[model samples]
Target: MSEDIEIAGEPSPPPAVKAKSRARTPTEIRLLARGHTKAALKVLVGLMRNDEATPAVRLSAANAILDRGWGKSAQPIESGEEGLETVHRVERIIVRPEDAVEGDADPKA
Candidate 1:
């Protein structure tokens, strides 16, 4: 019986060490009108690094960034009258003329 009870070649890691090896959850990312570009970039990088970010969330973030970066017009509806008004409203809300300028304009121009 003693001969059968041989010591293992390698010992198992401690419980705490095992727990520490577990994967971390990605933090929730948020972006607002202010600092939207920087925040979006950070979130993009985070999503690339973090295994926890779902494909849907990443796509949504990318879409948000593109929509904000470019002045994309709203989709027109088939109704063509009230639908057009709704589309205009969406364009007004999403697209900002102030945010269009990248930096200080030339005083000479």
Candidate 2:
């Protein structure tokens, strides 16, 4: 009875806090940039589609649209095999002059 009363009087432990993920991910950055690009493209399309706009302004907008597709060069991604170990084999060969002459008559001597 006393132990139960003491336990009841004691406060419970605080709950465990979850660790926060503070680092920005590549996918998150890409999505954010995509949103900004889409917003810019919407404005550009509006400029190109407006009839009141000058031909030069509309032409510039049209060029912007086409440049997005073919202006930038393609980037090649470098990739290599993972979890692979390379092994090299080495061999040594030695031949002495006396050993070579032993097989011959050594006519010069």
Candidate 3:
């Protein structure tokens, strides 16, 4: 036996909506750099080649591409073997103002 269902005056709940999937918006060149350097490089190259790109942006891209191609600015490399014993000799120049000859009337004197 089927039970009878009563449809009250209230309207039935709206149909479940399927969430829409949106394509990720294009990301900024800098932000893209953090995640994928190579991809960011491509974007930079594109920007450099694009005539529509602002002069500043194109210039920046050109600089960035050059930097990437030539490698980032020189970093002070700690040129030493880690966990290995090493000794370095440092020579420092000591200025002795008192050593000036007393009779030598320096212009400043």
Candidate 4:
């Protein structure tokens, strides 16, 4: 009887799978830099032409331009406490007024 029981099929899997899924590619990096320079130039021209536009609007437009030019990445959050606590920070650089226009001398000069 004991030998008969040992001849049974392999044991079944546990109720749950403990292993995590593999990470997949989020987004294509090649498309990010495409047309970026042209889009930035256009945004700059728009800002120069529309002095009445608010700074916030201009900045939003700039961001949009960059986002469109460079496709977004798919950043997936892992299933863990670290994922919940993760934070992303973005930094922006603004061209000073004196430095914006061509052939303009430094304000301090």
Candidate 5:
């Protein structure tokens, strides 16, 4: 139930078109930076090699280089809800020497 009409001897304008912006995926972003990989690594290495830099800064740069070279080490996650600590149950069983032969829990056996 829509109609286009001429007003004041002028035709109506067309609907507005919105510009679409798409985010680059991780792979795409990495590809974009691939060209700068060498320079970036060089900068990191320079930072790592600079004795003037603080020990922590140097270590950070070294870690970054190592991460890129050999991938990052696996990290373990300890998940627990806020205000609560995660706990696990452990079970222990004791068997006497005689129980080993008959597989009985009775001490007499």
Candidate 6:
């Protein structure tokens, strides 16, 4: 979306866009992000190897690189009690932006 700015009493309208943009799928988003993975890893590696970085910051950078390469370690959930039952409750909510706002959404737009 383009932003329109109003200078003083004059209004500046942005150029009209002909094509509409649809939301990208998860795969598409991942592919787009993956394109920057090499650069991201390079930055991480630099941070991890930089002597000027704090030990904690360096450790964090190393961890990020390790996570990308080997994936995160599986975490085990613990009840932290002796023979105690840990019951989890799950709830799902769906929200529509058009319905959430009053008279803000246009079906044609």
Number of clashes in every candidate structure?
Answer: 0, 0, 0, 0, 0, 0
| Predicted candidate 6 versus true structure: per-residue lDDT over 9-105, tens digit per residue | 7766678989989999999999999999889989999999999999999999999988989999999778788788777999999877657677676
Q: Per-residue error at 46 for model 5, in Å?
A: 0.3
From the highest TM-score down, the ranking of the candidates is: 6, 5, 2, 3, 1, 4
**Most lDDT-accurate candidate:** 6
lDDT of 5 by residue, 19-100 (tens): 8889999999989899899899999999999999999999999999999889999995666656567679999999757558
Model 1: number of backbone collisions: 0
Candidates' C-alpha lDDT: 0.62, 0.82, 0.79, 0.69, 0.86, 0.87
lDDT of 2 by residue, 1-109 (tens): 5543547567977789899989889999889888799788988999999999999999999889888967955675545877566669898988665678556766457
Which residue ranges in model 4 land beyond 4 Å of their true spot? 1-49, 73-80, 83-109
Candidate 3, overall lDDT?
0.79
Worst 10 residues of 5 by lDDT: 1-10
For TM-score, the strongest prediction is 6
Model 1 per-residue lDDT tens digits across residues 34-88: 4476765787767755667888877776776666679566984577555354323
Tell me the tens digit of each residue's lDDT in model 3 across 17-62. 9999876556755576577877888889999999998999999999
- Whichever of 3 and 4 has more TM-score, that candidate is 3
* TM-scores of the models, in the order given: 0.33, 0.35, 0.35, 0.27, 0.48, 0.55
Please say which candidate is ahead in lDDT: 4 or 6. 6
Q: What does candidate 4's lDDT look like per residue over 12-107, in tens digits?
A: 556886889776454544456554867767876697457699888777777666666697657887766653675699999988876668777766
lDDT of 3 at 74: 71
Identify the runs in model 1 with alpha carbons over 4 angstroms from their true place. Answer: 1-37, 48-51, 80-109
